[model samples]
Target: MAGTQSYVDDLSGTLDERLIISSTPQRSNALSNKFSGVLSASYADSEIRDALHSLDENEIKNTAETRRRLRLNVQKQVIQRNGAVVQEYGHVAEQLKRIGAIINSLTACCEVMRQHVTAARHENAPVLEEASSLLVQKQELETKKQLLDAFNKHFIMSEEDLLVLTGATEAVDDTFFGVLMRVKQIYVDCQVLLGTENQRLGLELMDQSSRNLNIGYQKLYRWIQKEFKTLNLESPQISSIIRRALRALAERPTLFQSCLDLFAETREHILTDAFYSALTGSSSGDNQNPVTKAIEFYAHEPLRYVGDMLAWTHSAAVSEREALESLFISDGDEISKGFKAGRQAEPWSAGDDEAFDGRKALGELVNRNLAGVARALRQRIEQVLQNHEDAVLLYKIANLVIFYRVTFIKLLGPDSSMLETLSSLVQSALRQFQTVVSDNASAIQAEIAAPTPDLRIPAFLDEALAQFTTLLKTYDSSLTAASSSVADFKSIISQALNPFLATCEKMAKETNEPSAGIFMTNCLIAAKTTLSAYDFVQDRVSELNEQLASLTSSLVEYQHAFFLHTSGLHPLLAALAPTEDTPGSLLNISTLPPFQLQPLTDAGQTLDDFLPSALMDAMENLKRLGNTKLSQEITADAAERFCEDFEFVEGKLTAADELREIALREGGEENEKEEQELVPLRSLFPRTSGEIRVLLS
Candidate 1:
């Protein structure tokens, strides 16, 4: 046992030591050259030691590294070889199994194919039993066919043979087929046997065509001589062509088709016109546009079907023929047909007669196709508008406007044109009148003749009216606001003058018109009256001049207020909010800002604006009034009266101010009845004209 263990240890030491020594490239190479000697030496022999002793430590380290790497590579190869062996074993098993299955499957397929082929072969073999019966049936059929063919080939009859058979000895228009039917009826009626006469009649009833209809009958006939040509008995196919040609001759064009084709296109237009007439019940036209004519048609319908009296009458304005002509007829045959077809055709669906409910279908409308036509019309109009322009444009627009206003309005309904209906009616009437008279040469002198609108007077009127109304509103509002200010000032003065006047005489004297007062009244009145009468459209075009007076007075007041506020003279006002400026204004009056009234001298620079000039003018008028009063000996009297009047006005104003302030602060206006009890001022004043009675104090 010890010896065995020692050998094992020695073997391990030999491998370890050999591996370390052969680590370097030189030592490895040396080992490889002596490989046979080293391997051949016994495990216990020292010859292996002699080979290893040739290696150094560095060499040993390299040899050991190489051996470590080589051992790992050897381990990997052993693993891969084992894996390959396992995979091959699995592959062999699978292939063997698959081969067995293929053989078994082929055996099954061959058996199936053999059974199918055998069954097919058995099914193909003819059977004697069915053949016998089939032969019998075929022979029987051939015998019958031969008999029929013989009868077809030889059949013939003469005219005389038909007299007794058909019971028609005289000539008749009745057909031979009809005569045959009569003979058959005789058999049905009598149920009796007759001799050759009965047979003759049946033969005769076979008809004239029946004689030629026989097979080979033409070949037997002498009409071979009629053509004065040799018969083509060799080519039977030519005989079929002849037969077909005869049939073609028998079938001619239908009478209906021939008549209709002659009038197809013409019929369509005629039918279209007729349909339109049925829908509208009106006239044939010459060169009138279809749309225009359709529109005019409704007007004429009463005359067409209902007679001249009805035709003369119309649903529209009967005053003139042209008014009836301008109708708005939208050309949609579908809707038109639906509406009118009811009265003309079927009363309704589900009625007694099928023909009553018989209009073709909804398909005929072709809304898309009609829309295309309308689109084409629109494009044509646009082209004419673009190219011909001045001449065509005005004419087209006028005509269309006439149609819309006159014809369409009246046609749709009495109230259809109710929107601006009056305006439309008036415009249409005017247009028609103008068209009639304007185109004709005037017999009168030029000065007396009225000018008609060969132009679009109404359209221009509408556009101008729109602009005029807008501006007029703006001007009117401004004028109204300014008038309020002046009236308030005048009221204030009048009330002041009243307080100082104790008697009628004093009242008359105080109220006399100051030079400025007359002018102020006149200015205010001029503005109010003129603005009130303003017409936005054509009626009073000249009235625009009247607007200037109101504009002036209002502008004056606006300027005065602006002056007082902007110049720091008064507390409450600035340039009144300005209207936004735009171009083409008849007046640049819109851009002017309200001016601050500089004191008479401070404003001496330029009083081009309203307020300053107005104020100065009022002042000048007052000064002139004062000069007129200068001749009065009591110039002081006038001055005193002015002060008195001023003070009285001031008092009244103060009273009004206090009342307003009370209404705001404590609503004392509500307590007026309660305050009425506190009055004591009237008792203090004595009846005047007593010259200071001694007890005056």
Candidate 2:
């Protein structure tokens, strides 16, 4: 078996060499190319080795047979796969044929469809064009429908709205206001339409809206007028409905102004009637409740009567303004907007911007309301002023008128006719007061008598001051703010006190010296006491103090002279008087005849006697001074003057004594003889300045 296997191996080796190396080049190339994708030499060797290892021993021994059987199995599998591939290819061919048939049928159908489409296009050309036109029309119609719907929604007023706007009997409620507002908006929108390029519809709408707006404003104007005719200003509040109507009416400047005029006229009549009712006790409305008694009841008292009339007017003015405040001022912004809208609608109304100020409107209304009553008030007050003869009373009335002037200025503004009337009344009263005062002063001056023996102020001057006191008190008690500066009160002082005091002074000038001083002092003291209590009169008080000082100086001089005369020193002082033309030798008082030792001794005796009672006698001299304190001061001041005179005398006496001693020591016989004739200074005057001060003190 080994020999047989060896021979078979050799044979296999010989067959491999012949097949691989000895082949023709073309065959070898073909064989290599065929196997190149089939299996690599290394891979084939590895597979053969694995197969050999996997085989049992029996299979190894049967390797040749195994190889033959494996070859056959692989060939059979290849044949089966080939048959399967052939069958699959046949099925694929059948499917391709079926797809071709389907494609052919689709192509035929496409050809038919194309033919039909071409035929239709040729037959219906106008229809297609018409259909396209219809589509465009539909879109255009849709757009117009939308625009018309919006126009109807915004621009067209419903029947109900028109009725509310134009209904004559309709109340001026919020619905009326809303309808009016819509109509105005439509009118304004019409203006925008008028501005557009296509303005036919805009013109139609504008005409309709303008007519509706005019009717609406007419209705508002009429309604406001009717309401005003019935408005009771005694009530503090106004209705909101009226305010709404006024605000709406403000859109038509002419109509709004007309309404205000009618309202103001109605209020004027009402206030005038009420004034009469207050004055005549003719019962009106609840407004009469405040004035329980008629103004006529106070007619006996001029101040109270005129005061009541003015108070009533003021109260009525305030009430009327408050009631109408909401109708104008409270709706200022709304009214302004209304006016602005009107201006936009009517260009000519642009200047009506100033008309929207509620404050000014209210003031005008108040002034108009008080117009009729104001004239009557002024006439009556002036009548009362003219009838009264008392200057102080007339001044009080003037102050009353001034107080009302200020009050009305605050309530109705400074420009109101009521304030004008009050101002005129104030001037009238002041003029009459001055006239009455001048007449009274002239009468008193004409009836002037000698001052009383006691040097007291005369009865007429006292009466004048008492009236002045009342005047000052009236001014102080007034409602106006009192000015602290003295200049502010100078007019009143000049008018009330100064003229009367001047008359007193003129009369005093006709009297004797001391009596004139005393009486004038009394008058000044009375005036000062009256004015000193009021702060506004402090300047007058200071002036009176200065005048008093002047008079006191005069009294001091008088008292000093009295002292000199009482002490018998007047002649000595007269002798000692230095004449401007006196020669030098006689210039010395010792050389003068009155200063001789005998004359000095006699004057010294008189002064010594008078010193004990000098101050008392001086007090007696000025006893009529109304101010006792001033009298004592003048007496003391005079005593000081008396002491100064004694000091001067003592100085002269010492000088004369020194001259005499010098002559006795160093002079000739005649000089010594002259010195002996002159008395010693101690013997000449017994009184010293210190003793005089002690006595006076």
Best by TM-score: 2
* Backbone clashes in model 2, listed as residue pairs: none
Error of 2 at 316 (Å): 1.8
lDDT of 2 by residue, 1-697 (tens): 4433453466467567866775676666766665554334453477655544444322334355655686676577679989999999999999999999999999999999999999999999999999999999999999999999999989999988888888776677889888888877887788788888999999999899999988888887888888889887667688778887777776777788788788778877777877888787774554554646677976778888988888888888878778778877778989988887777667787765564677987898889978989988988888898788888888888888888888888888878988889889988988898888788777777876677778887777788888888987888877757554456457768877787788778878778877788788888988898888888878779999999889888877887888888888788667655533233323355667766678778888888888877777777867887888978887888788877976776665566566557656677776776766756755776677898889898
lDDT score, candidate 2, position 399? 85
Q: After superposition, how far is residue 250 of candidate 2 from its true place, in Å?
A: 1.1
Question: Compared to the true structure, candidate 2 yields what TM-score?
Answer: 0.82
TM-score of model 1 relative to the true fold? Answer: 0.19
lDDT of 1 by residue, 1-697 (tens): 3333344456557866877775666655655657556456584557644434433212433344655685575577679989999999999999999999999999999999999998986886567557888999999999999987864433433444344223323322224334433433443333232244476544443433343332112221222222214322223233432332222211111221232233233323433444344334463663334443342345343212222211222221122112211111221232233334333222443243222111121111111112222232233333333343232223333334333334423433333322133234334433443333233212111222211212111222233233323434433333224435444223222221112111222222333333223333332233333334443322222333344344334433443343333333232112222312222221222122322232322322222232234333433433422123321212233323323432332333234334534444454665676455432211211112121111111
Candidates' lDDT values, in order?
Answer: 0.34, 0.78
lDDT of 2: 0.78
* Cα-based TM-score, every candidate: 0.19, 0.82
Error of 2 at 359 (Å): 1.9
